[model samples]
Target: MSNYKPIDAKREEFRKYLEHAGVMDALTKVLVSLYEETEKPEDALEYVRKHLGGITESSSNTDALRKELDESQAQVTELKAKLAKFETEAGNE
Candidate 1:
């Protein structure tokens, strides 16, 4: 059904968002380690941001990413519920 397409798309988008989150988390860890070792958080942050394009001087990107990550997670949960319902119905038929 047409409705299924949107769910599928959202699921795929959520997967991408999770992947991005994982990458961001890794970068954060790496930056933290560098900062601790070098005693220069600003330098480490700058290096990390430079290596990972799309991170601007402002915190807007971080906020947006967090929001998108949360939205994606919720969408994935909804998609899973829909999938379970569809599977149950199919099994009953």
Candidate 2:
């Protein structure tokens, strides 16, 4: 039949259509961002919307910086405890 085609051929045509629509690039970026997230978003659609809506990088950077600051603060607390223990031991000696 003239209308018959292999599944791979149909898939290739669909891929071409998505590429032509610029969806391939946008989808790739969104997927990469999603994959790199340390804290997976609760609302997947909202995350995708914010990313696709041309929101600036500042928001993402802010999130990363905040997480870094929290981790640093925790490390400082641990170091402080270790220092306190060392001081106590030296005082006993």
Candidate 3:
């Protein structure tokens, strides 16, 4: 039998969190674009910067983030209400 190791919970949580945030998808697209270049650009840093510079630059995206936060909070409130209803039904059953 082969030894099957369990995934670390924290790392898995973080990966899912990044995926939920679209960070992994964005980075994958940038890396794929870099890989498809026929000839590497003279300034490798510039090439990567051109493709990936905005990944961590949140200062310029504050309004977008605020909108997302508002939407997420609304979703949380909806889910919590659903959960509470389910719990009440379960208790009654």
Candidate 4:
């Protein structure tokens, strides 16, 4: 059986984040140029590994970034919920 798997959905999500964050477009341009010059996928991958090590260093960093953003959003949501609760309590008081 073929063992190929599709790209991770998270990768696309992160790629979108990078694009919005102004990293994906730059990486795409660099990787495309390298691919054209080398005519080799491995070479282009190596170029990305070396040149864009910031994003590829570890999954932890990616997870941490994602988690951090999520936590910040959660905090905002929790604060809003608490504020509403407090407002209700004060109204009752």
Candidate 2 regions exceeding 4 Å error are 1-11, 55-93
lDDT of each: 0.73, 0.88, 0.86, 0.79
Relative to the true structure, candidate 3 reaches a TM of 0.48
Per-model TM against the reference: 0.40, 0.45, 0.48, 0.39
- Candidate 3, poorest ten consecutive residues by summed lDDT: 51-60
Instruction: State the displacement of the C-alpha of residue 74, model 2, in Å, after optimal TM-score superposition.
Output: 52
Encode model 1's per-residue lDDT on 1-93: one tens digit a residue: 355544588888887897777865666766666657645555655766654554333467778889999999999999999999999999999
The TM-score of predicted model 1 comes to 0.40
- Tell me the tens digit of each residue's lDDT in model 4 across 1-93: 899988799988987898898787768866776667745565656777755765445767878999999999999999999999999999998
Residue 24 in candidate 2 has what lDDT?
Answer: 87
lDDT score of residue 57 within candidate 4: 57
Which candidate order results from sorting by TM-score in descending order?
Answer: 3, 2, 1, 4
Model 1 lDDT, full chain set:
0.73
Give me the runs in candidate 1 sitting further than 4 Å from their true place. 1-57
Superposed on all Cα atoms, model 3 deviates from the true structure by an RMSD in Å of 15.4
Error in Å for residue 9 of model 1: 52
